[model samples]
Target chain A: MTRLTRHDARRILDGRDRSGRLGALLDAAAASARPAELGGEDDVLTAFRAAPRHAVRPSRRFLARFVVVKAVIAVALLGGVALAASSSLTPGGEGSPGQPVAEGGRADPAPNTPTEPVETPTAPTPSPSDTSIKPFKGEDGEDPPEPGRPSGKRLKQLCRLFLDDPRGARAEKDYPGLEERAGSLERVRRFCERLLGEGGDDGDGKGEDPQDTNPSPKPSASHEDTSGPGGPHNGPQGHKGLSARSDGTYVG
Target chain B: MRPPPPETDTELSACVDAARSGDEDAFRALFRAVQPRLLRYLRVLVGADAEDVASETWLQIARDLRGFKGDFDGFRGWAATIGRHRALDHVRHQRRRPAAPVPDEDLTDLEAPSDTAAMAVDALSTDAALTLIASLPQDQAEAVLLRVVMGLDARSAGKVLGKRPGAVRTAAHRGLRRLAARLGPDADARPTDPMIPAGALTPRDAT
Candidate 1:
């Protein structure tokens, strides 16, 4: 049936007071629902006075909570300062008042000793160990390189960079042609290796370096895989996995 | 001036006048006379937690009772305004509470027997219906209940709900639509005439 129109609504409401079923019901309800204890306004007042102060003086409780929070913050600040100062005073901090001599290590001077300030040569940095081992060749039957592991600060810096600008880290390879964008060869090489070494054949893998666009070989596919980073449909093309909004565009 | 006792309408007005003149008993009597209806109104407008709200409403009335200068109806309207505010406060409080399953057994008893029976005669007495009505977005439900059940006209209901008369009518319409939907097909069979038709002489029709 078509929903009750407003006129019908008005009718139902009006008919409730008649002697018919609905009307009788309404009458009974109205009669029975006479709110009692209506004269006990003083009792309600007495209860109001007896009830919790927190309900009555909310601002006071709020102030108390604020004071407690401030006191805790003050204690925490004092404790942190004390801990930091004590730790800095402990034995193994930076270089002592006087101690050692190594190229990249600390220099030392003893008490009462007139030491000549020597100009230490800022040495040429040692080159990183070659990581030229190719990601396992398909025919060799070796597993794809485990990209999850990396050495020293490289891993930390990579993690920090990825965490900070995840999008840029993924698209690092697409950047070389852009004028202001520059990346170190080692960093680029590492990014490329990480991209290529991930085992999944899907081109949609995230945390991938945009420079290496090669489609990995599927375990089920025996055909020779030809798609690589510089291939026509490969590099910096068709990245996926970002969220799409209602407007039919990818969101951050 | 000595405060008048607020047992009757004249007493209530005199009590208010005396309280205005700094008579504490007059103020206390005024509070006693109005507190019950205000509490019941709050309890219905809000929920069971209206005890606290009722308390707060009275405290406000005690503080502001002298400010009201009118006949008994005006005093009632003033107290009603305070009660409505307390009810709103309770509503806001309920919203802030985390959602949890309302146990079926928890709803075993409700205080509105007469109301339930009234609804039952029309076969509209389901607990769910009451809850659904109560749970409707506040503006709509308040307008509908104040106007329909309490017999307040749109203008008076609007004043109690702090909305314009047009807004109150709209809210009541929307609220009834929602309530009809909740009622399912049964609401179709109900009579279709205004409960209180315009220009009705009898108090029953008037309400």
Candidate 2:
């Protein structure tokens, strides 16, 4: 029971008839990996042809889901249109009548009273002062100001707002129609002005210049080893005989 | 009628392009051409599970055949690399699952029975030497296979194994030494045969 010498290790490691072993191994591998029961050359060819086609075709599951989604949307749209059409055809159902209705099936008001007065004033035209609040224009028409300014107490409130609960921001309505809040819109507008900047100045600490284009590591007095430690030359430059090249390249 | 000589890489590339466009026959020819090499590589990578790995490798190649971008040689190497990886994975799996025990037969040391008669009458066969080689470890086996089967030099073998050329040369040297040891002290004294037959275990009858 002697330990194998380097020579023995080498001899064993370098032995020749590797191809036969490789062949044997290949046979063993082929036995297990290939789809053997699938049949012979014709079967293989068929499978090969079928496989690529199957891969290119959309998966049945995906196609099925796509059809179901499209059908559901189409049904919903058709149902909406049918309801709309039925409502339009039925009288006294929001659609305007051709003539004015009478209590006893007779025209009541005088025609001179004006069937449709030209200056009846249906709704007042909004004044410029009423529409004073304009949308905050963004830089390059992108990443618009997030609305509202945040100063001292409001800034502190904002800090608490985010720190207390970040999800609260989503609940705040930026538009007029739904879920009105008490003075929250103004607060948000002011907060956004401070956060996004009074004029889209980017009030966030990053400010106007986002990326730091210039970077400077601390200067060190240590000299570089040009000769590469073990190589010839005395100075840190390590240049043995030749000085700097004419093109300003360091010659070692 | 003799069909035109075996398709070259350029021809194969053109065939693969057609195959990608659903040209069934062209794809089949490409598969037949590369399957053998892929199988061989996988076998080396995974000893007994070559079939499973080779099948899986081919199926994968078939699935991704349309996406193949390289020339024939590149395609071959890429496929081999994939097969090698799959084979390695199978080997790892087998190691995890303890299977049947390997026979304690030391084929490495099996000495070819003395054949003084062959030297006297028939020529020495290369298979005798190769059989002696098969008894070596996987590394030596691969080195020999690459050299003899692929006709690669020691440097090329090193490139395949990602090792230094000197290391491959040393491995080859050691492999020959083991062969000599198996042949007995007088093995070197026996005339060495150079010619080899394809596929068969026996070398060409002594030159």
lDDT of each: 0.38, 0.37
- For every model in order, the TM-score on chain A comes to 0.23, 0.18
- State the lDDT of candidate 2 residue by residue for A163-194, as single tens digits: 22322432222221110111222122233434
Model 1, B1-207: lDDT tens digits are 111222667667676566644566665666655554454345345444445566656654553343334544445545665565444433422332324222223222223344444444332222222334444555665565554444455655555544566887777777766655543334333434312222212221111
Q: Which ten residues in a row are the worst by lDDT in model 2 chain A?
A: A132-141
> Model 1: what is its DockQ?
0.04
Q: Write the per-residue lDDT of candidate 1 for residues A1-252, one digit (tens) a residue.
A: 245555554554443323333332233222222222343455545533433231222343345455556545544544454455456765442342222221121121221112111111011111212110111011112112233335334443443344333323423332222101112211332343353345332222333433333433223222111112211211222111100110011000
Using Cα atoms, each model's DockQ against the true complex is: 0.04, 0.03
Error of 2 at A112 (Å): 66
Tens digit per residue, CA lDDT, model 2, B1-207? 111226876787677667655687876666666664454443334433445566655554554454444445434533553454344434432332335321223221122343466432221232233343444554554555444433334554554443455776666666555544443333222233332223323222112
Angstrom error of the Cα, residue A114, model 1: value is 88
Native contact recovery (fnat) for each candidate is 0.05, 0.04
iRMS, all models: 26.4, 25.6
Return the top candidate by TM-score: 1
Alpha-carbon deviation at B166 in model 2, angstroms: 8.2
Candidate 1 overall lDDT versus native: 0.38
Q: Which stretches of candidate 2 lie above 4 Å from their native place?
A: A1-44, A52-252, B1-5, B99-134, B143-207
